[model samples]
Target chain A: MMDTEHLGTHISKQFNADLENLREEVLAMGGIVEEQITLALDAFTNNDSDIADKVIANEKMVNAKEMKIDEACTKVLAKRQPAAGDLRLIVTILKTITDLERMGDEAEKVARMAKAIANKEMAVANVKLHYGALLHLGNHVKKMLHDALDAFARMDVESAVNVAKLDNQADEEYNAISRQLITYMMEEPRRISEVLDFMWSARALERIGDHANNICEYVVYLVQGEDVRHKSWDEMQRLAKDE
Target chain B: MMDTEHLGTHISKQFNADLENLREEVLAMGGIVEEQITLALDAFTNNDSDIADKVIANEKMVNAKEMKIDEACTKVLAKRQPAAGDLRLIVTILKTITDLERMGDEAEKVARMAKAIANKEMAVANVKLHYGALLHLGNHVKKMLHDALDAFARMDVESAVNVAKLDNQADEEYNAISRQLITYMMEEPRRISEVLDFMWSARALERIGDHANNICEYVVYLVQGEDVRHKSWDEMQRLAKDE
Candidate 1:
């Protein structure tokens, strides 16, 4: 939970409560999105159609939650007209939920891939062997998302920068996995479709890392009142380290 | 240009001017993004490295424009505290710019692919024969984006809905292209890497269609004050028709 005490101390207490509630709702949404990624990866790893089905079912709830939070942020903006940090808080929440919702969409993509792979008549051993790299990438992005939300909750710029940096690592992993999958496809052209599915799953996880990084960037924007989006690594580091 | 007449008419004339200025900025940004897609497709179709270079160079300007528009919108929200339709306009602009910036990124990606394919030793005839479906998909999405921006400029729900529905056609074209590319790759395993690049370019174009669709949805939200995001096609059509 955010420290509601410092948010809009000059404003009415009700406004503070509203901001607090908004933050919690975003975190709650983040939690569900995080779980979706986990279950999606698990479904792929274990070929669990039931788990994949659950993830697909959860997407509706995620979309509704995004709309709900977006409305709340708009209400706060319209009624409270919060300025400065308070204004940034509302804006950040609005942008953060969009990322969360997209992350959920990526998770759904992963689930669909998992379901497709599970229903195929391929051997489970081959599936696991081919997708081990995907699981590694999935865990990397899943952790990145979790830490990004944590950074947002505490308004921690250092933590945000740290998590944002992880996206580069996730990208490297994705590239390596893609190269390996390409090799597999080249070696066994008959399995090209299956290898491509894993490639897409890896792509989805990589995008999850991207969404998490975007959330971290939003945190920096919220705290510093600066738009660091599209900044180079060194420029972003300098801004984040300037405290 | 959006008619500045009705926006914030109840407020001070200055605030109305601010909203009008903001709308024009968004349209200007949309124009640049639209051109990026067009140039990227031409670069790929013609195997023209010079045009590809231009698209890559244009991305930075696109990013800067997005940040500029975002800052202006934030200022308006803080200074004007706009409500009702005015608030929705500001929020829609904020969200719309994010999609536009992403579209710029996708264009840059397409340009990079074109450069890669151009620098390769493959014959231009082979390239064209292999990528005909990709060019077809690219043209479909390009037209969809153009229509989507036109819809946004007019804020016409009918136009917006029509453009939003085009995304389904874009997806089908993308699917056909992907399957064709897969067949090409399977037929000539040695050309796997080159064909995969075309696949990625097609994927980028498909995503551009998605971003364009998102813009149309934002237009609907702006006009109708309804959240049509994540809604089914039928649901979105019903809401749009409800006027």
Candidate 2:
């Protein structure tokens, strides 16, 4: 029989626990995205097409997990009719899952670019193409994603703000690598396809960094009810610290 | 004064109207994005950086509408404690506003690229770069976005599926333009930056098309409660029509 009265204002322990389970599911899916980014980056730097294939293969896992979490959150919303903070948590989960799914899509794009470049001469021309910088940028983006998920798990606004600050580094790294690669493309056209592929991979990482930053902003919104997208990094840090 | 009894499950008319208000707000935001895409495309084809500047300026309008709609949705979710279809509508709005905002960002990126290429001699060389193909692809994406929003407003599942199928044309257009531009870059290195700029604009439109497709998928979930992302386009078409 339906426990129709469970939707009342009195908090139910089972519902609260169910909410926690949803957050845990989000964290679990996030861990997989972290793995996808790491493997995809490894494939790029090592020219390991095998790992690239794995990244491609693992994308299905991310999509499946997203569907699962989304269904769980929707069920909770429809059944619980949760208010205030509980409502915020479920809504945030509903929104962030899409962001996380897009991050998976970006990682898959990077992996595909990696596979395309694996046998190319530019794979060996790492120095000529600033491949190390791209790797560094990719690694940094992966770390920010990890920390952002951790922040969400803990509802740690400070860590989330710090993640946004890290995006500046990602942006700088992307610009530096794009300029270097663009110059290379113009100066010497022999490895143009290979160089462009490397640039595309780096660009994908840069976008992933932006997505991670977006996730962090959502964390702030969930915790503080403030939209921080317009705030400067320093302002975001101060907001997190103040509360 | 607050409606104290709104906490109950009687389905208040005011609350229902408020939910309708939220959907109207989303539709309003959708209208702005449609304008942004149209202007951005005009900017690209005409090499009219001034129109591109207008699109950039309009980005703020889209952002403002998104923030307002988001805050309004969160308010309704927290206060009304809406269940079932009302709840789904709010959740979908929460998720889709982000997608619309990202579409606005992509339009802004295209506009910026247009401005960068406007005064260049290569702007006139768009004919050589398959700019018409990009324009056609972008127009298709805009139409899909328009139809997707219309489908969402009406909760029309069949139209949403049709919007997803249109993504195929966008993908083909993107590939055709990319392949043609890559050949041009290889054959003549003089206008490499211009050609690359064109490619980036086309790529941004393609991503916008994907975002539009994402919006349509959310509409299906809102209406049918079915997660259709995993389904093949053919399957999605069959499912939408079957229901």
Per-residue lDDT of candidate 1, residues B138-166 (tens digit): 77877877888788888988888887788
Worst 10 residues of 1 chain B by lDDT: B1-10
- Score each candidate by Cα lDDT: 0.87, 0.84
lDDT of 2 at A233: 91
Report how far off residue B107 is in candidate 1 (Å). Answer: 0.5
DockQ of each: 0.69, 0.58
Query: Once superposed on the true structure, which residue ranges of model 2 sit more than 4 Å away at CA?
Result: A1-11, A119-129, B1-11, B119-129
- Candidate 1, residues A1-243, lDDT tens digits: the string is 333335455657888889999999999999999999999999998889999999999999999999999999898898777777888788888889989999999999999999999999585465467677888899999999999999999999988998878999999999998887787778778778877888999999999999999999999888888888888767888987788
* lDDT score at residue B103, model 1, on the 0-100 scale: 90
DockQ for model 1 equals 0.69
Give candidates' CA RMSD values in order. Answer: 4.4, 2.9
- Model 2 steric clash pairs: none
Q: Model 1, which residues run further than 4 Å from truth? A: A1-11, B1-11, B123-127
lDDT of 2 by residue, B29-53 (tens): 9999989999998887788989999
Clashing pairs in 1: none
lDDT of 2 by residue, A46-88 (tens): 8889999999999999999999998888788877777788877
Q: After superposition, how far is residue B170 of candidate 1 from its true place, in Å?
A: 0.4
